[model samples]
Target: MFVAEAAGLDAIAATGTLRVPRTIAHGISGEQGYLVLEYLELGSRGKADLLGERLAALHRCTADQFGFAGDNFIGTTLQPNARTNDWVGFWRRHRLGFQLRLAARNGYGGRLQSLGEQLLGALPAFFAGYSPQPSLLHGDLWSGNHGFLADGTPAIFDPAAYYGDRECDLAMTELFGGFPESFYAAYRAIWPLDPGYATRRDLYNLYHILNHANLFSGGYTTQAEQMMQKLLIAHS
Candidate 1:
């Protein structure tokens, strides 16, 4: 696990997609594995246009395949990322299947499971003609994971880093809310998202909400249910 994390971190740095911390140290703290990363400083304009432009450039970086060297951790759980040439297949297996299975184990069955299956089946149609290359992504790129440096440069941290669809990166940004209008505008100017992206956004976000429901069962269950229903309606 540590080796895989190190490899992904190295890949991110090598690609110049996002800034990887200078020191990625691993050690044993009792029975658990610990990873220590350098701290990044944030400035006042965390959502500045320059940072937006940088993130756009990062997302534009792509590869021939859509998978990582190995799976890594997200929040505290292991994310299974088996390598695959097909972007749709990779997403189904690692992103959708893995998250849905975990959610099911945590008592999120019935409608949630059914909708997940449907979404998986519909992925190809949803992403038609969009053969996504392995883009360097800060996989868990929600609002909280990114900040601006002292000079207003964007600094992304706590990456669930991987090579997958750029839309996944954009979808996550909308999930929380730190991203500004300039960010989306800058990204569109560089590499425009597909028209179907709006439809797929809810489907993609369902994975995260379901994961949250599994992790902390509060209002997330209801939220996940609602998202699933919305997707079902769209597909129908």
Candidate 2:
């Protein structure tokens, strides 16, 4: 696990725009995996604009397909990265379908499952006019995962990195509240988001909510239902 995470950081830094902690070492000892990274003193706050611009720059790095070259983790959950050309197909099979199947195995069913099916069937409608290209993503860009270093350099870490719709990273930033308007503005200035991103943002976020429901409490299931309802209503 630690080796995978360290490799993810290395992958992000390879983009040449973002700053990530250098991976010093990684190995598994006994039942535990260990990774050694360069120690960084994070400042009290991050420069949101810089991070956003840098994030946009990172997203500019594109991929030929809608998954990573290899699989990685998202909050310790197994995230598969089998490659596919179709964007919607990739999300349906990998993101939404994968999570829903896991939830069913974990004994979450009924309305959540029903609504999830309906939403999954309508996934194509969500991207009726928008054709997304594969781009490098932090995979988990929540507020807690990024900040400025002691030297005031913008640094982002703890990534579940992959090649997918850049909007996935953008949507997760909104899930938590640490990013500033300047950050968003900077991102837009670099790569303007397509129209309908507002509603599709909920669709993108549902992946996380569903994952949360599987990983934690039933509250996330409720939230996922609400997100599904919103999408259905919008389509209707």
Best of the candidates, TM-score: 2
TM-score of each: 0.89, 0.96
Error of 2 at 160 (Å): 0.6
Off by over 4 Å in 1: 1-5, 29-32
lDDT computed for candidate 1: 0.75
Q: Please, what are the lDDT tens digits per residue for candidate 1 over residues 1-236?
A: 66556666666677665566654698788999877777777654755566567677776777767777778877767887777788778778887788888888887788878877887787777676666667778788787776777666677766777878778888988998647888888778778888888988876777677678778889987898788677667766
**Residue 35's C-alpha lDDT in candidate 2?**
90
lDDT of 1 at 195: 88
* RMSD (CA, angstroms), candidate 1: 2.1
